[model samples]
Target: MEFPPLPLFTEVELKSEIARVATFKKVPKGETLIRQGQYLKVLPIVVSGAIRVFQTFEDREILLYYVRANETCIMSLTACLFNNESASYAITDAPTQVLYIPSDYITDWQTRYPSWNKFILAAYRNRYDELLHEFTDAVFKKMDERVLDYLRNYRDTHSVHTIPISHQALALELGTTRVVISRILKSFELEGLIGLHRGSITLKKPF
Candidate 1:
């Protein structure tokens, strides 16, 4: 099947540029799309399924966020666009398919194709908008509200109300300590607001 068209490239554009692009399928669960601390050589667009962006601490891996179908994953675009080394990881959390465009393709497009250059600008603009939203939310929203927002945005639809995330993972994402998270989660459990398990938390109601 033809990949669904994203605003980055229209049908005509993709058809004309097919020779420079490639597609890859990735199986679910624990697949690393791009390793941490390595150079990012390709810009990837999710064709299907989902992927998680994360970073590893001394014995823990903290999830930053996820990218679903139709979204693009370029965590360190500033560095990648400048051909600098990458400092973050992009890994697939679900079975996924992606369209990969080589790094040089961007330079070639900027020099040879103005239309494609506009598309690249649009892509960067979208990423910038997302980052701004996150920053604004972080500054203005309460911790509990931010946790709820994260749950709403990232929860698994197949089952469970709360997102499948560890306490430490949530702590790192929220920029807090695990002890603080544990206290909040315990209060949630006591209030019948949520249920906690070994690796996940389940929202009870109004989630």
Candidate 2:
């Protein structure tokens, strides 16, 4: 498949390596592209939009990070590099376009293409920084403060005052129990900061 001009690829690589294995795909919003324990066969590079990367622990889930346009998922890269099953799930947060490369070509491409190696290293470093922030939030932030920040960030990014998410989903994203989330949301409602709906939360006032 033909790809748009990628940032770091030689003319030789474009002609010789990419054409042999890369495939282009259009993914719709809310689609699950990768599931935990799934076999690693393809590596996806986002050309547009967001992919939510998270891990499921039994009955609950915790968001790990997001893979946006021009970025790759470190968990997927690790799975492909180590030749193991996927350890986390990836879902499209919005309709997206992506370039898919067969995992078989990863080793050779990295070895033969310095630009590809640089891209992979840069992606890893970026994810490491995000993980560091996540650790800091978990260790130092209070639950209510973190939840408020999460809602504010979510609203700002989606450009909507109403967040269409369930308390269960919010709990999973925040790494807390649903009951706890419900209690906190109720508290927010009582404080007139937000209003709770059947499956969503509407911001009533700034936090």
Computed on alpha carbons, the lDDT of every model, listed in order, comes to 0.71, 0.86
List model 1 lDDT by residue over 133-175, tens digit each: 8889889987777776776666543444756779987898878
For candidate 1, give the lDDT of residue 141. 87
Task: Judging by TM-score against the true structure, name the best candidate.
Answer: 2
Question: TM-scores of all models?
Answer: 0.78, 0.84
Could you say which candidate leads in lDDT? 2
lDDT of 1: 0.71
* Number of backbone collisions per candidate: 0, 0
Q: What is the lDDT of residue 154 in candidate 1?
A: 62
After superposition on all C-alphas, the RMSD of every candidate to the true structure, in Å, is 3.2, 2.7
